[model samples]
Target: MTGATQRVADALRDAIEAGTYPPGGALPSSEDLAKAHGVAKVTAQKAVNQLAAEGYLTVVRRQPARVAEGPRRLSVVRDRKVYRDQIGYYFDQNAKPWGAIGTPTRGVATPPAHIADLLGTPRGRDVMTRTRLMAPKGSKVAHQVAISYIPVPVVAEVPAVGSSNTGPGGIYDRFEEHYGGPLEWRETVSARQSTSEEQTQLQIPANSSVLVVTREARIASGRTAVVVEVNETTMSAARFAVSYPIERDSSAGWSSTGGPRD
Candidate 1:
């Protein structure tokens, strides 16, 4: 990718992050973006393709591209013991919401095979899904793009979904409120790739790197609640942090007196 591509990617990332292109909002066409950026249509198309591959944008057949919805504002502190379960496990008591806004986008078919496995159901099971672009607070750029899937049954209970624009508070909170229990456990796996759709959403240059994070969450009763899949181009400059605690030994050969040992 040329510097122009990077420039385009950065510009688009900012737009998504800042709510310029709200979730489910359509992005300008390649020709329009090219004219806006003073670049060739090919360059604009390339940049858009990169964003789409990274999960920032989705391209529908014969339809214009759109911005994906991202995570609601939630923060996780490193190394804190928040909760315990059957096994001794430490959990974060407080989660700071990342500034990513959640706008309901047009529902799409589930593509990845792993998502079906997480749902413990068939790939074509009428699952409810949404996509978002994530822009953390105090940041000028949008770093990550995410898609979430839940059983249709789960979403039908909320009734507020598929309509209205909800800010940083994501579906997880809504599910807990309506269903009566918080998400107790989550598992995540990450990788790197460039999908056709991500290139458009992230506006990544050709050959630029991207990251994918797949996560699953469940309630204390062992029922699957949500599956989140994220794709982010390196240009978005998104970062994630994790923390844990270690025990300290206070009795390690420290003498009460300041005298040297004989």
Candidate 2:
């Protein structure tokens, strides 16, 4: 992915990042780029294709490739505060704050082995599931995908959560209200190549990667009540900034400092 093709693509990417071609704005045609850069037309097309695969551009039929919209930057900070009438933090920050959520698909499904383990349930157990595909208010493309799972027992206690119309503040609010006590949450983040299913749901190029976040919610009774997995096409690596508070203790050497405690 280097040499002439990459050089040209890098130049165009830089221009796009600098806002020379904003989202929904078209870049120069391959013919124009070939003539301007003294390269073959095929080389120019390859460069454009590379940009598209990298999530920087998209093709328009009967027209030149257009600059793709950048991903919304989300800050992941260390905090355990729960607000009344608030949707889960990630949903609130990335989706609900900007627009209404598309109707979520609600039902019960068998949990995957890994999810079952996290929820402390036997494999193949049926669990309450809520899946959502969300786009910002005026955007045409969905930018976020989330699937939340609640053990069958937890669902029995808070039946309202099983419905798509879990009302304002969402399921977390219902948990606090019906389950008796404030809720606590912790999140673990990881990334990998997007699977075919993820590609289809996110409408991203096959070459693009995705960020996977695992969120766990615990009730006052100290039971892990919910586990949610969120997937999104990776934005430009340079775009996201993350911060976590560190507790300092002289008694423990720097090497001995444990991970953040929720």
lDDT of each structure? Answer: 0.58, 0.65
TM values, all candidates: 0.48, 0.58
Segments of candidate 1 deviating more than 4 angstroms = 1-106, 137-141, 165-169, 220-262
For candidate 1, lDDT tens digit of each residue in 1-262? 8989878877886676545686788998888999999999989988888778777888787777898765132233434233543332333334233444445364746646667777665776666667766555544444566666666655566755444553334455565665577655444534455566666666554443454545565654346444322221122323233334565455444455974333
Q: Write the residue-wise lDDT of candidate 2 on 84-203 in tens digits.
A: 324454423333355435676877888668678888778987887777775556444445567787888777777787775888777777878875776667666666676676666665
Per-structure clash totals for the candidates: 43, 0
How well does candidate 1 score on lDDT at residue 193?
58
Lowest-sum lDDT 10-residue window in model 1: 228-237
With candidate 2 superimposed using the best TM-score fit, by how many Å does residue 136's alpha carbon deviate from the native? 2.1
- Candidate 2 vs. truth: CA RMSD? 10.8
Alpha carbon deviation, residue 189, candidate 2 (Å)? 0.6
lDDT of 1 at 205: 42
Report the Cα lDDT for candidate 1: 0.58
